[model samples]
Target chain A: MTPRLFQRTASAVLVVLITVSVLFPLAWMAIAGFKGRNEVLRSPFQFFPDMWRFDNYVDIARDPEFTRAMGVTFAGALIFTALSLVVNSLAAYAFARLEFRGKRFWWVYCVMPMFIPMMAILLTSFMVVTKLGMLNTMAVLIIPGVASGAQMFFIRQFYLGFPVAVEEAAMIDGASRWQIFLKLFLPQSAAPFVVMGIASYLAFWNAYVWPILTITDPNLTQIMQFLGTFRSARGNDWGMLMAGSTLASLPTILLLLVFQRFIVNGVRISGIK
Target chain B: MALTPTLAPGPQTADAGRSARGRRGRVKTPPHRRDNRTAYLMIAPMVILLGIFVMWPLVYSVYLSTYEINFYRGSTFVGLQFYRYVLESPDFWHSIVVGLYYSALTVPAMIIIALLLASFIKTLSRRAAAFMKTTVYLPTVVSTVVASVLFVLIYQDEGVANWLLSLISFGPVNWLNDPQLALPAIAVPGIWLGFGLTTLILLAALLDIPESYYEQAALDGAGFFARLWYVTLPLLKNVLLYLFVTGFTLAIQMIDLPLIMTNGGPSEATNTPNLYIFNTFRDVTPYATSYSLTASLLLFVVIGAISAVVFRLVRSDKAIDG
Candidate 1:
């Protein structure tokens, strides 16, 4: 074979290998969710289930704690997303457009949290939240993350790229600073807002450690918290675990499918993680 | 018309905005003058939240590390005793070693795999590349805990993994149950769920390379491997460096996988420092809180040092220029 033909064959094989390795686990999870309890742990494992058990999902649906956890997690994520969008974008606008005393100083001060890894402060932040009597409350989940240096920085960069002509045009129309920001700048920033919104929502939804520390009440448990605890308690029940994990991953998966463009952009822009 | 003098472009804003200032003819202040009150109001929420929660806690962690907490009586100032104790503890050192081990397993492997997959994918048809990219990235949206649960099933003795080995005429292996195999077993899922994003990022970098570089190399009779080594890799140096530093730091701090999969078990082979600190916090004792805090700070300092050394070693002024 020619060198080019060999290379093409190798590329094809690698592509198939990469795709299967990447997806086979997820496909297993989805398939296993439909298997009967005995079938999941059956020796010389069967790739396909004898009977597709929809009752696994039915069990999840009948679970009040699971439903409540889903509600609480979704509500908290939405609220957090809204709050971070407002708070971070406001700060981003100020950093991008407004000039003030100690601009450099305060900018550094606001974005300083980026320098400290969250794990380093996790213990003390838990203590602080506990001291404020916010443990087991949704406020603990939402409040601490509302002010994000990374989001502020990202939005600031986006805003800086905006043409200055629009703002000047708005100013000539006798708009106040508030009017220009509220009416002009904010609307024009829909793309970054969508990016930040999806990012914040996903962060809140996918959070594990902090939720475990702060929320012990089953009703207040986040989805990941619920899944983690459930996985341990029901260690032998592979069917239930797969069902719950599928349910847990559904929203984010759906979001990715629907908002592929924005999510990919967000990942590209915030590539550190 | 630039009624808001703050809209001017530079430190020397008066001259730049003079055209608009003259058009508006309503300038009553210096061109560089800013609306301090508006800026202050705009930034108030972030400043206040970050101060009370983020900044204050960082400082307070240092303070908490110095003092020992006693729930029965009260807290007392120990003045770095906890720090010294934690630093000297063999378990603390073991946890650090485990963290380093995990990073060693993850960082380079992920980078190389990602690099190869990305460069290969770059040669595909655009449609095929898009399909590959989407499939690879699909798992990234799954929460870490959920992925761990899926892997827990996959790594079971009677699970798909062992069944696959059976296909190759190998015996079933205890993946998470064996001390020797557990850490590496756990790293499999970490790489599985992780490298997709890295591949996507690297693929983007690969696509950005100018065709002329490859053409230039081919004109000099460079083979595929030579062209890749000389042209492609050098152009991707900054991005690779950035990914390496960030990926290594993140890997060393891994908690979700170990915490869920092994709980740092099989003779504590997978107990990352973050896991050790977490376990200490959960199983509280008189000085557990302070010990955990000190350990956390130490780990942070080590991570800082590692990042700094890598950045220093790769001290290209263009390290993050893209």
Candidate 2:
């Protein structure tokens, strides 16, 4: 083969290899979820289960704790994301549109949380959460995270990216700044709101440490956290574990399938680039 | 024109509206700075929330770091002693080495893999490029715990590797359990998770590379490596440095995988500082996990050093530019 053909072929193979490396483990996970305990341990050729075990799904679902964890995750994700949208966007809007005293300071403090590594802050935040006697509740979990840097930054980016003509028109109409913000600016920021909203949903959905940190109540844990219980359990059942993991991953997978375009656009805007 | 009356600029006329309020039962509205007040009110929720949750807690962490006290219980103050202890701890030193080791493994591997993928993907049609990019990034959105759990099942003893190994007449390598291999095993999943984002970044960057550079190199009959070294690498130096800092920062805080898969297991071999802090706080208590003051203090210094290092790298780069 010519050198060019060889290079193209080599590149094609590498691309396929990278894709397989990323996706294969996930495929293995799906395969394992259906595998029997014996099959899970079999030779490589028999890696796919001879018989699919449907019982693990029923067993995991039958557990009341898992169901409750679902409730917690939904509540936590919804309330926290909403609260963050309201709170951080307000500040974000203010910074983007308002001529406030100490605007720079407000902007700094608003986005400062992004820098305080969770490792550095979680230790003290836990203490505060403990001292406040708000443990074992999703309320605290949702509330603390409601003022996040990522959300504020994204919302502010949206606000900054918005056109000034609308604000000027609002002023001409004698609309108050708040009126302009609520009625004018917000309506135009749907793109970023969607982005921030999905990011918040996924973040809250994926969060583990905070719930495990703040809430010890077995009942209040999110689905992800409940799934994590398998990790610490003695003699991990690979089949049952993968089944739980597969189920836990389903919503997110479904999310991607549905909103992949929105997610990509959102990720681009949200600095995941 | 009517709004100018609201200004009431002259001192003599400032009280005129107040005195005239009796004559007009419907009092003229006080000069309304509605815009400023509304802006302030709009931002108040975020300000209060951030102050209490992020800013205050971070300050309190820094404050707590300076003292000598037990977090779970109560204690007296001894300023800077905790920093000294944290500086002195063998575990803390080990953590630094381990963090650097993980970053050392991840950043270089990720860059190379990302570059390879970007170059490969660039050769694809636009529609195909988009699909491939999406597929690669799809894993990033999955919760880390879920990903970690998935990998754990694959890495299990008598699991996929062993099954595959028997076909090749090779022994099942203890992928995760062995102390010597545990960190690398964990690091592999991390690199997998990381490579897509980096690939996308580099690809986006590569698309912007002036065609002239490649044209010039092609005319010279330069090999791919030569083009990469002579053209791509120098142009991408700043972005590469930025990724180095950002990727290193995130990798240093490796928590979810260790938490979900190993919990720093087999002998704390994968015990990252986050997990260690987690263990200290919740080693016993469910909610009041960070009760150990010393543990909290130690983590502060450790993370602070990391932050300083990352910041210093950026600053030095800026200095060099200046």
Candidate 3:
């Protein structure tokens, strides 16, 4: 083969190899969700099940604890996303558009928490939540996450690049600052808002340590903690475990498939910039 | 003032225009004050939330480090005793060493593998690249819990990992239960989960490199390796360093994967510092809080110093680039 052909063929092979490696475990999980416990344990490399089982999904759906945990996770993610957008956007707008004294100092103050690893503050944050008498309640999950430095930073970066002429024109028309922000800025910056919203939603949904620590009530438990404890309790039941895993992962995976572009853009913008 | 003549003149044109200009100037000055008010109003919620949750806790963590907190009783002062105790504890040192070892295993492996995958994908057709990108990135969307569960199934003695090993005539390996193999086994999923994001970031960096640079290199009789070395690596330096720093930070703060997969099993071989902190907090004794808080403070200091140095290096690179 010519050198170009050789290179092209090599690239294709490597790409296929990577695709398989990435997908196999996920594919196995999905497949194992349909397998019997015995088949899952005995024939680990079996590509297909002898018969598909819809009972696992039905069982998981009927499980009150699983359903309750899912509801808690969903509500937590939604509330966290909405509140984060409001709080972070307002702060971002102030940092981006308004001229204020001590702007630089406050900017640093707001953004500094991004550097402090969340694990490092786990205990103190738990204490703070405990002191507020918010433990085992949804408030502990939602309130602490309402203000995110990273979200504020990302939104601020988006706003900084926004055209000031639009807001300027609105001001010239006797529009109040609030009116201009409500009418113009929000509509214009919808993309970044969605990006941050989805990002925060996924984060809140996937949060494990905080929820595990705070919520001991089975009814208030998040999906991750539920799935983890469920696995530990029924370690030998691969079929049921994989079924629960698939259920827990389905929403985020679907979200990713739908908003893959925005997710990639968000990661790149936040990480690289 | 320069554009004042563009406006229509009225009966009291001169006075009206002068007053209009005066009014404009006066309007501008208070809006600055109004903007300040608005700014403060806008930032209040975030400021309050971050202060109560983050800033206060940060200070409280330090204070808690110096006290012996008991659940039954109140906190008692124990200035720097816990700190000294933690520093002297072999378990604390072991956890730090494990954290470093995990970082050493994952960071370079993630960077190199991610870079290769990114470069390879860059050579594919657009459609093929998109498919590969999505497939590779699929793992990242899976939560650490889910990933850990999946890997646990695979690493079991009769699972796919051993099944694959048997193909090469090797015996079943105790991937997680064996202390010697636990850390490395756990690092496998960590690398797998991490490389996709790193690859995507590197791909972004790679795509940002102008095609003209490659063409120019080719014109200068540069081969693929020469072009990559001369034109790509230099441009990718910042991104590579970024990946390294982030990867290092993540590897050190690893909690969920080890927590779920091994739970620092087989005698705490895979017990990261974060896990150590976690377990310390789980201790129900009166002095557990102080010890855990002290360990957390140590972690914070070490991570802070490392980040500060890495950030300094990044800033210096930007200086050189500018």
Taking every candidate in turn, the Cα RMSD to the unseen true structure, in Å, is 6.2, 10.2, 9.3
For candidate 1, give the lDDT of residue B195. 85
Instruction: Residues A1-273, candidate 2: write the lDDT tens digits.
Output: 999989778767866776786788888777777877656656544646778778777777776777677777877778876776777677778766666455557767766566556776677777787888888876677777777665666676556667788778778888877788788877777777666766677778888777776777877877777777765653667677777777777776777667666654554454322
RMSD in Å for model 1: 6.2
Q: Candidates' TM-scores?
A: 0.91, 0.85, 0.92
TM-score of chain B of 2: 0.78
Off by over 4 Å in 2: A1-15, A231-235, A267-273, B1-35, B66-74, B165-168, B283-322
**What DockQ would you assign to candidate 3?**
0.47
Q: List where candidate 3 sits over 4 angstroms from the true fold.
A: A1-9, A271-273, B1-34, B318-322
Model 3 chain B scores worst on lDDT over the 10 consecutive residues at B1-10
- To one decimal place, how large is model 3's interface RMSD in Å? 14.4
Candidate 1, chain B, TM-score (2 decimals): 0.88
lDDT of 3 by residue, A118-196 (tens): 7667789889999999999999989887888877777776776667787788888999877977887888777788777
Off by over 4 Å in 1: A1-16, A267-273, B1-32, B316-322
How far in Å is the alpha carbon of B93 misplaced in model 2?
Answer: 1.5
lDDT by residue for model 1 (A1-273), tens: 999999888878888997887888888898898988778878978988998889888998778888898999999989999999999899998887787777779988976666576778898898899999999889999999899887887777667667889889888888888898899888888778877777788788989998888898877988888888885566577887788889888898888777776655654544331
- Give the CA lDDT, 0 to 100, for residue B312 in model 2: 71
Best by TM-score: 3
